[model samples]
Target: MNRTSFRGKGKRVEFPFREAFWMSLEQIRKRLKRSIILVGSIALGISLLTHLEMTNVILATYMSSMGSTMEAYQFWLIIVSLFVCGIGLINANLIAIYERYREIGTMKCLGAMDQHVMKLFLIESLIFGAVGGVLGFSFGTITAIASSSVQLGINALSFTPLEAILRYLAISTGLSVLLSVISTMYPALRAARLNPVEALRHNI
Candidate 1:
C-alpha cells in the first residue's frame, strides 16, 4: 500500500505513522494540563476497578471463598464508574477539539487528511491510556495491599499469589487502554470531519 503524503510548501511530505506518533507526543506535552486531566480520569477509573478486583482476589486467597453478593455489588459500582469516566473522557476530547479549532484548520488547510487527524488523536489517547493504566494499577495495587494488610496483618501479602496479582494487573491495564480509545472515538471522528474554513473561523 502507498503511504499517505501531505502537501507542504509545494513539496509532498510523507505523514507516516511514526511522524503522527511523535506529533501526538508533542501535543500531549504542549497540552500538559489537559493531558494530565485525561490521564487522571483514566487512572481514577482504572484504579477503582483494580482496587475492587485486587481486594476480591486477596480475600478469596485468604478465605478460600468468594463473596458473590459483594462482588456483584462492586461490579455494578465499577460499571457505573467506568460509564462516568467514559463520559468525562468524551467531554474532554470535545473540548480539546474546540480549543484546537484553529490548529486543526491550519493543518487541514496545509493538506492534512481526515485519517491523519484521527490517527493523531487516537495515538494521543493510546499514550494517555497506557500511562494512566500503569499509574492506576500501581496505585490500586498498593491501596489493596495496604488495606489487606490492615485486615490480615501482613499475612495477606505473604499469601497473595504473585501470578494472580500480575494477571490482574495486565487485565486492568489493558482494560484502561481499551476504555480510553473507545471513549475518544466519537470526538476524534468529529475533529477529523471538521470543515477547515469553519474551524478556522470558529472562536474558542
Candidate 2:
C-alpha cells in the first residue's frame, strides 16, 4: 500500500485514522485532566460529608458525653467542605464538556456514531470512578485500621466496625457512579446533536 504524505508546497493531505486517533487521544487527555480535577473536588466534598455524618453518628451514641459541642463543629466542617468540593467538580466537568465541542464534531464528521461518542465519554468516567474508588477505599480502610490504636486528645476511640466501613464504601461507589452518569449526560447529548460541517469548522 502506498501512503501519501503532503510535503513542502505540494498537496494538502487527507486526514488518516492514525492522525485522527492521535488527535482524538489528545482531546481525550485534555478532557480527562479536567475531569480528574473535578473528581478530586467531588471526592473532597463527599469525604467531608461523610466525616460530618460519622461525627453525628458518634454524637448520637454519646449524647451524655461532654464533647457534643465540639463534635457539632466537626460535623459542620465536614458538611461544608464537601459542599464546596462537589460544586467544584460539577463545574469542572461542565467546562470540559463545553470545551470539547469541536472534537466531538470532528469525530462525528469521520463517521463516528453518536452512540460511540457517548460511550467514549462514559468509559472515561468509569475509568476515573473505578480508580478513585479503589484508592479511596484502600486509604479509608487503612485509616480506620490505624485509628483502632490512636489515643485521641479529645476522646479514646474504638476501631471502626468493618461492616460499617464496607457499607460506606459501597455507598460511596454508588454515588460516584451516579455522578459519572449525570456528568456525561449533557455532553453526550450535545455530541449526539452536533452538525458535522460546523463541527469540523469549530476551532478549539
Instruction: Return the top candidate by lDDT.
Output: 1
lDDT (CA) for every model shown? 0.86, 0.55
Tens-digit lDDT string for candidate 1 (76-138): 999999999999999999999899998889888878978888988999999999999999988
lDDT by residue (tens digit), candidate 2, 118-187: 6656666665565555455555454434443353323423424445567767866676566556666776
Model 1 ranges with Cα > 4 A deviation: 1-14, 67-70
TM-score of each: 0.91, 0.62
lDDT of 2: 0.55
Error of 1 at 127 (Å): 0.5
- The parts of candidate 2 lying over 4 Å away from their true place are 1-32, 56-90, 133-157
Predictions: Cα RMSD each: 3.9, 8.9
Q: What TM-score does candidate 2 reach?
A: 0.62
